[model samples]
Target: MESNGTGGEANAPENLLGTSPGASSLRSRTESECSDKLARFVLPSMDGSPPKVLTLNEVGDVLKNIQNMELVHEIAINPEFKFEPYEPPENSLERRIKDIMHKAFWDVLRGQLNENPPCYDHAIQLLAEIKDCFPQIISQNNTRALQHINEILDIDVIKQQAEEGVLDFRAYANFVIHLMAKSCAPARDELVRQLTEIEDVVDTFKNILETMALMKLDMVNYLLDFARNDIMANSVEYEKKKFKEYLEYYKFGFPATENWLKNSCIHDANNKPCSPEQTISNAYMELMDWDESKEFPEVLSIDKERILKLGQRAKRLCTCAAVISICSGVPVISQRTENRVALAKQIDIILQGTTNEKELLDSIENVWLQVKTVINEYLQKEDQPVIDANTEDMLKSQIMQTGNKDSPVRTLMWKRFQTYFRLAMRSRAGLPPPPPGYADFKDELEAYCTALKRVIAYNHSVFGEYFMKVLTQQRVTSTDTTTSAAAAAASATESVEPVSSSAAAVTEEKSVNSQ
Candidate 1:
């Protein structure tokens, strides 16, 4: 392959000397230029004195070492080796083998980079090429892998840093090595299986693996150090990059209809002057003023953007209701005009202080508890005869209980109420009513809400599961340490007892003889 002009093989002595007769002068010129370039590639020593310039011989040796390393890497991931079928080792053996293989891989990588720093670019390129050998290594799709790579090695950032002469090639190389290991896991596993099967080479493989694992860890530390320094040095710039990426996924500004609530209050159905508060208050009242002849308003909407906004509002309302009910020890009356007014006021207050998505979601969870309370109350009343208004109020006052906040029933009720509240509010006076084919739109909206809830719930559950796993691991580790310590103490006591008994026996014998 032709040199990439970054001083790979182009400056090799053999390449420089092996020129045509007519190009003897050109060869000498090239040699002189290469020597000058090699001199400029001065690496600083640990003692931080004068930088050490590479001699032609040292450069040749470095290039040779890099070539040999690349050759070994290629051989390790050879198609023939990867395709060789072999029985996997037993579970215990497999774990050991895996650990060893990882160590070996990383050790070689670290040494290769440290010895020949200029080979960093080639090493990274080789890793990218090797990734293609094991297509099934990463669980995520290729697109996602590309996106992850792009994020870590943003080309713009690289260019900017390079121009500024502050680019850390070693850190970048470590990151690439880490990625290569990850991408080559399947291939490595296969190779490990084959190696472990061979008794003669097992020890060598284990040694290699151990080295690689240690090197991989070092690489991780190095990358982390780089990130720490970079963040500390350019905090604002780092944050700007992060924020720019986040904005690409989620829009920053509120929707166009963000003022829907305010607008609802300003105009009546006829576009006449009206009290926005009163209009909103009456809309809540109309939720319970259901007529037997009039069909229920479509509970779904097709306009996803609009529905999303409505969902946000509904979530806010639910949260406000929950907080109020929890704090005041009052059963949230969804239909009462006064309650709706109170909810709106609470929502306003909540919104005023809310600064992030997390806060908003937390608020919604609070309201979800109240919804659960109401649902449970209704379920309990299912078998009982219809109580009079006064009797119902008495029952509510006496028996209303705040159940487990994380109850599944609460989540279900919360979801149902989310849809109901969104539909009801959207149909409010002065607001745009559900468009034509409202029924289908309502179905679509409900589906959208259900899917959204599922995604949120799934994410929450994943985090919860991870947290539990970490706690369990910590507990297990603590228990193991305690048990080991106890066992050691007991063993020590047993050993000391024997010695004590022997000493006592000797003393008794001596005493008897003396007597």
Candidate 2:
């Protein structure tokens, strides 16, 4: 019993066809039966048995037939789709799959125009079912898979496959080109190309996709710093305007924080007499590294006005830090001023302590802790609560009555009068210009600062006073509506102007007269 590897049926040729032994299978079997058998038996070869060999040529012809079925099915259904390989016993499966696919493509080229939706529908259904059962087809069948496929067919097998399917490969390709030209919208050109170049289509796509991904990553890396810079630039534009307004208001509060890392306190705390220029240089370097200088708001919501109040506050602290820098140096000139470094440390604490929501919250909190220590020891004598409460109340009142009452303006003027008067008092007695170093200046920057403070504080105070005065006058005028109402109104108007002017003049005079 010599087993001629023909496992189909021991008597397949004899039993199925009435004619005996060796009639050519391709010519004898009806195309439909061969196709049905191929789909039912050979195509779905998942059973663990080795497939019975038809004559090698016979098998090739059968595969070629199956390819036509697949394509006609695909076209009637997914006419646009190319057949992907199948799975299971990976290498063998792919070889069988590529044989069928190659024939189908050839058939499509050979003028098998399938416009019928039913065939298309069945092909779509069949391919989808096959795909579900065998998702790893191509991935499983790599280079070696192609070699195995070549073992089964002629290098020219694809050409014959196309010929038998009645396809003209070149004409089909040109037809595809014509169809793409006719397409009015973005079409699946790449997918068509993949199908046309079936053997290495997946490999090429993989490379293209990889290259595109790398390009995207490179672009993002290049733009990361720019994005960060844009954020900072926007912040600076907004913040600078606010700072300018704050400078106009002349309330210096937040100097320390903006340059904290520069002050040598963080880096060289034990060293005495740090050079101011050197300290500034070091801090500037640190600032250059920050990606957020432009990101701070131009005006902070300190009480509600869009004054660069946050920056002003920071500037104040910076100045205090500057004073520390000066003091830290003072130990060299006067042994008595050896304690200035410590005093500088105290100033750092005070400046760090004052803060609000938009302030760099953590830094402010940390600085405040230092300030608290200083306050606990040295500033114990000053009535911090009283001064703070007074300033806060005055500021709030000025804001509330900004346009509502001219009295708010008058109250500000009166406050200015008081500030100039105090400075004048300080100057007439010649009492060392408020400690540290207020003496060395021709523009009289200190006097100007003092005058500006007077102006702001006066605006705050006089407004409150005049608001109350007008309120009283209104009550009196309402009840006693005759002559006193007009007189009181006239007096209030005359008094407000003279007062604000006199106050401003006094402030300027004190500025000059004191210096």
lDDT, candidates in the order shown: 0.42, 0.36
lDDT of 2 by residue, 1-515 (tens): 01323345433322211221232233234446445243222211223444343344554343333333322322322212333333446468777887688566535523333433112222223223322322122223355643443343222443444445543334433332343223212333454344345443223323333333333343343444345445333433333333333223222222233224224323356633344444433332332123243322111112122223432442333344333333233223124343444555454454454444234333433343443344334434444332245543443343233212134343443343334334543463432343233222212334434433332332233223323343344446544774677889888989798888999999999999989
Highest TM-score: give the candidate number: 1
Clashes of each: 13, 40
lDDT accuracy of residue 356 in candidate 2: 40
User: How well is each residue in 1-515 modelled by candidate 1, as lDDT tens digits?
Assistant: 12323265564432321222221111123345655444333333334355455554544454454343332322322222222223466678887897688677656655654553222443444334433323334434577776677676765666566556565654554454455555544435454444334442223334333434443444444444445544334533332343333223222221221222222344458854454334433333333212224322221111233334444543443334334333333333333445544443543464444433456644454444443454445435556333356644543432222122343433443555544535544453422333321222344334434444432222223223323343345456756997999999999999899899999999999999999
Worst-scoring 10-residue span by lDDT in model 1: 19-28
